[model samples]
Target: MRRTRAATTAAITLSLLAATACGGGSANGDGGSNSAPKELTYWASNQGPDIAADEATLAPELKKFEERTGIKVKLEVIPWPDLLGRILAATASGQGPDVLNIGNTWSASLQATGALLPWDGRNFDAIGGKDRFVASAIGSSGATGQDPAAVPLYSMSYALYYNKKMFREAGIEKPPATWDEMVTVGQRLSKDGKWALGAEGSNLANNIHQVFVLAKQHGADFFDAAGKPAFDGPATVDAVKQYVDLMAKDRIIAPGNAEYAQNQSLQDFAAGKTAMVLWQSAATSFKTHGMKEGDWGVAPVPVPAGGAPGTGRNTNSMVAGINMAVFRNTDNIDGSLAFVKFMTGDEEQRLLNKAYGSIPPVKAAQTDAAFASEDLTVLRETLSTSAAPLPQVPQESQFETTVGTAVKELFADAAAGRPVTTESVKAELTKAQQQMTS
Candidate 1:
């Protein structure tokens, strides 16, 4: 979990050309002054139409930006799950918004494409410099080979979310802080033949993030300096065993969980079919299918067995947020930077946090009463105190996907009553590492 400007090295100098154009990107800082009126196009997750409260709040902030900097932000919101494919296609064709919001995990893969603008003192002064964001999150956006290429945006992390009602019914006093305890409590809470652990199997990455956080709790680093697989180590093996045992040995999770992805289990959890789930903190707060505030509670991920006492790893919350970047090729670097600065500035972060329940990307904005009211202060606390970020390597995203996909399959095997032999896992992991390291 590292962040900051990488050393000026050849391997890291990504071009500022739009990746979609398949053209060479210029790294030169041609961003001009904020004196002129400039139109800046933005791409954001469609959290539904702008009528939604969260969606609607940006107007005031945008207006303020326009008045102050003479830059107009044309925001295009795309739903989270449905967005990646279109953005990738658009980017590959070298045409995308001058600034965009993207998942942190996507940073590495995107960096690999050799497009996107790098942030520095000249470009980022309006958005707060390296000092204002959480360190690990800042690192989440940088590639090891390059300078600090991206800035930290709003972020979220995963932990075990439990139904308070279910916990009360089971006579549990406090949330489980260890894997063994989760199994015991989950078993008790999951009754009436319903699944105890409702993991959406198709969403292997989310599950893996949870488990890997646990592995890191026990101290596992997946890749070394060369960006090679280090997953075969002891901590990781123990972590995988724990995950498999929850379903195969404990019989605590739902049946056929292998077939289910995030949406399925979210439906199950909202419907009260399961008691506990390891998911993003924001998932519980989602207002779909009648999800309400009192329905759930967030807890730190349980420590792995034999892990350090009083020591739990905050799996680096995926430093999730939309960053503002200028396409050097966009012909409006100053406009793009101005738009990014305004969109990610203190006022906007405070407003966005208030409207969307997002933790602020800039540290100066965290004092807002809105974050305190939503009680989302913990998300910021966790990212600062416990979480370690993904490595600042271009290969990190590919490796995470590989591991996530493997976990998905392995969990499926556990659900089907198949033996999780070491040989099988080693083979799968080896295959994944091969494709990635190549």
Candidate 2:
């Protein structure tokens, strides 16, 4: 029957919700006792739904939202592969969920369609709004001067995860603190069959971010205060070169990494094939990889050499997770906002993080000793001063593709003994800069 959360919402049929979220008033939407109290339909993505099939399965917080707002919320779990397309289709036809779970990076594109309302204005202030989230994560969710489009549900901060067992066995006294130490130790960790680093040759996004961290280490700003590409600067260029050399020139990375995805890197680390990996807060994959509790440790990304000697880049990093947004045309805009705020609030942040093992975006929850402990504490503290996001434009996803292609091409050239000069990279970034701006 494929009944939807919108259908389960107060006995209202999908047809009605389709009308409400889409801003179209279908006859069914305004008709029938099918609706006791007006309902708000929420479409959450696979990130949460993968752990729990639907909101009904995990509703302590959702129940609270329902109780406090007195508005029935129809929670729909849309698979990630299909999420953007389905939401776009529904919204375009004026028949979508009232609220949705969106990647923070998606804000610029989605907002371009004028499909959402910015939560930053005085129109709503439930969970502290901009102050509620770390700067980097919030910035990515489409910030246009006074109008920021989406609110954060939670964030997935990246950290360096190391195999303590491997480090101990190798007789390395402490985990590497700087890029040089990382490289030296990583080289030592590489054995007859194992690689030193979890990041392999492929995974261009990982490589690019590592370069970004390097750029930051050297005070390379991705964009100027006016928001334009700044990678043409020498510091940024150097960082990119260093990363390429690490894998291609230095040979510290594992073999056959070009074809490997992020998951493959995790598997290598978990299997003890690699000693260290750059991981996101969503390391539930750690346990899934048969890593025992405490088998691995987390640290802020280490800085490689550049800018100033012995100094790494700013600890600030771009946020890499999802945020929540309210559809502009929901039947119950007030009720929907209430739910959005509640989910992004401190209380819900705690539950969601604890349940899902992610970094909570709410500052208050980040301070919760119970939820944030040991190595994880760095997340909260660092988040205060060390968070950033990529450009919040409709073309961001496209931009990633452009940058990733360049990164991969550079790596391919390096691996095959081809020239990877600064001039070549500058030209590529120039083309990208043009594409991004135009």
Candidate 3:
């Protein structure tokens, strides 16, 4: 749901017209409706291998809901690129789906606009209480100490993935426990044109998440207590420099990696050209690239050498995923709320996240036998014990772009064989910080 850039005019215009024409009325300001609703409109995020696949997976769930509630849902699975613009247009035009999917990172920004209903006591009770969700998942649903504006629907976090065959060949008995150890293992594994680490250098959101994890491990935050941009501090600069050094100084990253995005990195890992990658929801893509379950192993990302002992190894991963919200403008409050509850129910969480290869948000689903696999267990533990939410600021989307672009530029310079020093990273981060505040 975190697309790097804006949408085209045609896409915006077409979606706007559809939203206005169909949804331009009775945005549920009052709790009461003029009449009982027969059906509700739902905007689903693209979570399957394809749109059709998602529809197929959810068809039974929707049918069951209609049968039980006597209210139907008309579902539209929006692609990630168009979702934000469509939601914005709907907000401006007083038109949008009754219930929709939003990336958890956008919760605070959308809440600031007051376009989505806050999950007060009534709504929280409807969806099984706050206790039913993972604490980290609920934490990311809105601003700290405030009523959540959305409910966690799917959960994900970055974990280290290593090729088991490569590890055995290199005589590495276990994955690296710290970043310094990783560098050593990577150096030993790199031989005859094969590198040890692969990353999505051009994936803006992915890069931002990576840098956030690194910065947190080194005791840094992207914003100060006063809410100003704080991307150029000592720890932040060190984090970016170390990430860039994977290619420039360590030389364990693939050459020409600046052009590679998420898919390319996975492809490299699956092809045995790289030994390690940090990823979330990698099972499907890992298979698509011809890797079987037994071929790769998953572990928590390594911490800095001198960080806190037990928890630091996994503490820094951003508690990021997707959430579901109800539009304030919708007249079908009852139907919309009902659908939200149904979607977060035990059955639906398992069905949807299983298809998406993401962890379920519900605590019950986390313990279900469906999620008992080793990789899922590690991810569940990470979410429970270590994951931290992205800073819940209205300027978060801007932070993603500005900081991501700076890191992207660093990657570009490194790919071109320029010397990437800590000072150079600090300068780019300072510029990014300026852009965020301005």
Leading candidate by TM-score: 3
lDDT of 1 by residue, 110-212 (tens): 6665556667666666555668776666777767656555666576655567777777877887888777787888778767877677776666556556655
- What TM-score, computed on C-alpha atoms, does each candidate reach? 0.82, 0.77, 0.87
Whole-model lDDT per candidate: 0.62, 0.64, 0.78
lDDT for residue 225 in candidate 2, whole number 0-100: 71
Candidate number that wins on lDDT, 2 or 3: 3
Superposition error at 397 for model 1 (Å): 2.1
lDDT (10s digit) by residue, model 2, range 66-159:
6776776767777544566565565455556677888776677666655565564553465455676766666667856647667767677567
Q: RMSD per prediction, one decimal?
A: 6.1, 7.0, 4.6
> For each predicted model, how many residue pairs clash, with residues at least 3 apart or on different chains?
17, 9, 1
Instruction: Give the least accurate 10-residue stretch of model 1, judged by summed lDDT.
Output: 1-10
Model 1 spans with C-alpha error above 4 angstroms: 1-24, 27-39, 46-74, 79-91, 126-128, 262-264, 305-322, 373-375
Model 1 TM-score is: 0.82
Worst 10 residues of 2 by lDDT: 1-10
